[model samples]
Target: MSSRASLKANLQLFVTRRCQLRCRYCPILKGDSLMPLATALKGADLLLGHQSGRVRLDFGGGEPLMNFEVVREASAYAARRAKALGKDLGFYMVTNAVLLDDAVLEWAAKRGVLLEFSMDGAREDHNRYKSAYDRGLDPYAATRAGVERALRAGSPHFVIVVASPSNVRRLAENFEHLYEIGVRRFDLSYAIGGVWSADEEKSFFSQVELVLTRHARELDCGAVQLGNARQRLEPTVLNSELMVDPDGSLHQMSEWMFETTPPTGEAPFHVGTLDTVKDINSLRWSRFHSYYTLVRLYDGRPDVRAALLNNISFGLRVGRFFRASGARLGKVPA
Candidate 1:
């Protein structure tokens, strides 16, 4: 379908704030306030009200699998509503997989929930970075078990790997390892709120681009494209997806939506909540979000525009200055 004509195809709904795993880089929770299940259901209803016939919802959470009952109940309700309203229904779960179980998988299969497992690579590679020093549980094993369960249930599955300074050097090995283990689809996202700095984040992006460019043929053998937060900035993909938080806050993109730090201050990222947005233009459209949006919105105002231009210029100057010094600026192939 053409971009303009396409109705929103997907939605990510945060069903709960609770999680079983304590991954080091989770950006969702501030403390421990879990969104009530009633509120979550209302949020789903709000989304369905907005795009009932066309939207497919993906269950999200601190660990979506941790709230298996909510996932199952919400799916059933949505499916029934969609069917009655003559709208299409689709479901997916973004899970740590630590708490995924056969009963949950069976229920999901019956309700038709697509499963996304957080498996970076082999147990050793996955554990190296995933182990929560305080939690003392193996995330690698938990993820592996979840993937196995999904495979057994014959559910479509996706694997997500978060790239950082610690993992960039091992991209090839990680990709190869997941492929060998029967994971056909995968995604790569950046680690948020970790020990990495801006330079490290930029370098990680460069490395992923280079890896894909150099090994496109081998890596492209997988069923899904390796994607990240920047994927939302691409115009072709924007209308096709939506990121709804646990409280039912809707975002234009999933990854960038969560990592959203307000233009200033300590806000993680987001302008407002889903309940408040009444039009398409209310979406957070950052100037540097993508080339298309940047060009379209560049009006050279005294405030917003000048600030954006200044920011861009400063980044460019910094890059040049870094090159002049002994600092490294990694390059990714086109």
Candidate 2:
């Protein structure tokens, strides 16, 4: 590892592979295997002990609260270690909001941990796709209570809705529905790992236009901001977020998102493991970090290639729309 003393290390940990719901489009779902406490602590040390002056730990999961012990303990450990090392530290949790409770909400508020919620607009639409269809549980119903509690508790948070071909037509209605429920900020994203047809693209843009029109005033006032006008207009397959999986293994976010059915390796995505990596500089770089490389590595899989290209296409088109519509989008908070 290079002695980059001023580097910032931001590590995202997948504390558990267990989830309560089986969303139709999720690519990272797996059995209920939890990350051992020792594994998570080692991961914390990788960042806290690094030369980085600033460090952040973001926790996600099949459902992180399912392994709340690790999330809570490792986070506390990291905070203390970072403080002792005279490093800046921050935390965030990406979750479905189904498992939130008073304890979690209070802890997040006190710790200043940003809670990123994954919810797709309305109940009917959410349950239709994001539901635990196998268990006949309504995901929207399960998460709404927790979301409300967090809002009341004043937890630092925002909501993200992933729009796909299946739900593009209802995007406007869904965005409106979320607003009615008191969510003031959002990140609207197109679903990846699948195709979006011509009609779907047109519908998606129209829906976005409607959302902008309805929320224009709030957007201009910065009361409610769309976080992704800048981010959404690019290829996300080679995302920059570094991911730490349950087994203490590390990979790039591009590789981690598709963990369920991994792509053929033109080059390995296993950058390093927490067991050995002591600094972010020690992390190995993968050839699959580029769109061109991903295209070659994902050969013979036309669907995946098409989806990747479509995502980039969406970015360009959306960027045009943002400029033309004069939509005011604020920078997404870190």
Candidate 3:
């Protein structure tokens, strides 16, 4: 890796494993246990000590609002600590929007929390997974209603949509609706739906690319625009704050960061608990760190110091298994 120092700006923190919505694609539902609140705090402390750059933390969840107390305490704690150290802490959460009642909206607004709501496309698309058949509320309507409530409460609202093949064709139309409703920042990501499989991802990636390009073209035409005049391009897949799992495990991205099935059968990764900084330190040179370190090394760019510490036992076996396995399976028909 090149010698450029690594800068860690955002932390994506997962606050809980319990969620109200049963989205088919969520990876946390596959995990075993939730991390305690004390453990989460310790992980935050570790990030502060080792990582350089703006220290922004994002509180994520099975439903962060479900653990509203944790959300409040962690954000407030990080806010105070970051400010005293002359660093900025950005706080936010991703939710299904079903849980955004008036009280929740108010609390978030008071704390300067930005809310990212999941919307598939239209009523049918949005409700397909959110409402399913058993729970028959209109998720599309609920999301719209919730957005209004949040905006009314003076909270900044962003719309994040996962594009599936079922709704890919209507990307522009759905986004236009959101833009008209005062949602300026649109995050578009490929849908990782249903069971995780290599074959499925191949097809999903192609479809997502096509849909994303189509939407990007509409933005170019300026048919619908955010009220802001900064002239920024819409973010297709932006980096978010680090995720703190219920177990106080630090994840670089969303809950999906822990989605791996280890070859050694050790399960996925967890950095450490919040109360003990030692768990955080013990994670040094573990598979987690090795993963990032190898990426930096292979990228052959300005090298950043690998703060990702992982246990070689788990990471190394998993590494060789994946590399060899992928090659062997590459020629198999998708």
TM-score versus the correct structure, for each prediction: 0.66, 0.89, 0.63
Q: Per-residue lDDT of 1-334 in model 2, one digit per residue for the tens?
A: 2343223367888999888888777877578689999988888888776566877888987889999988889988988888788998889899888889998987786667988888898888888778683576678987888889888988888888878788899998888888899998788777777777889989988888788778777787778877665434245555656778899887667664455655665633346687667777656443235454466557767767777787667766766766565545644354
- Per-residue lDDT of 175 in model 2: 87
Report the C-alpha displacement of residue 292, candidate 2, in angstroms. 5.9
Model 1, residue 324: displacement in angstroms?
28
**Least lDDT summed over 10 consecutive residues: which range in candidate 3?**
302-311
Which candidate, 2 or 3, has the higher TM-score? 2
Candidate 1 residue lDDT tens string, 137-216: 77787678778777766776667876656766676577677767677566655453334445665665565556556555
Best by TM-score: 2
**Full-model lDDT, candidate 2:** 0.76
Of candidate 2, the 10-residue stretch with the lowest lDDT total is 1-10
State how far residue 217 of model 1 sits from its true place (Å). 5.9
**Residue-by-residue lDDT tens digits, candidate 3, 1-334:** 2233224445566666666555644445533345566765665666566445565566666666667776677777776777777775566678777668977876676667767787766676676656533366666787778877776676776667665545556656766666667665555544432222344334543543453455454445543222222322122111223456665545544224324312222323344445543432233222234345234333432221121122222223323433443322122111
Most lDDT-accurate candidate: 2
What's each prediction's clash count? 3, 1, 27
> Residue 268 deviation, candidate 1, in Å?
13
Question: lDDT value for candidate 1?
Answer: 0.57
Superposed model 3: Cα runs more than 4 Å off: 1-6, 30-35, 50-53, 132-137, 193-242, 251-334
Which 10 successive residues of model 1 have the least lDDT summed? 325-334
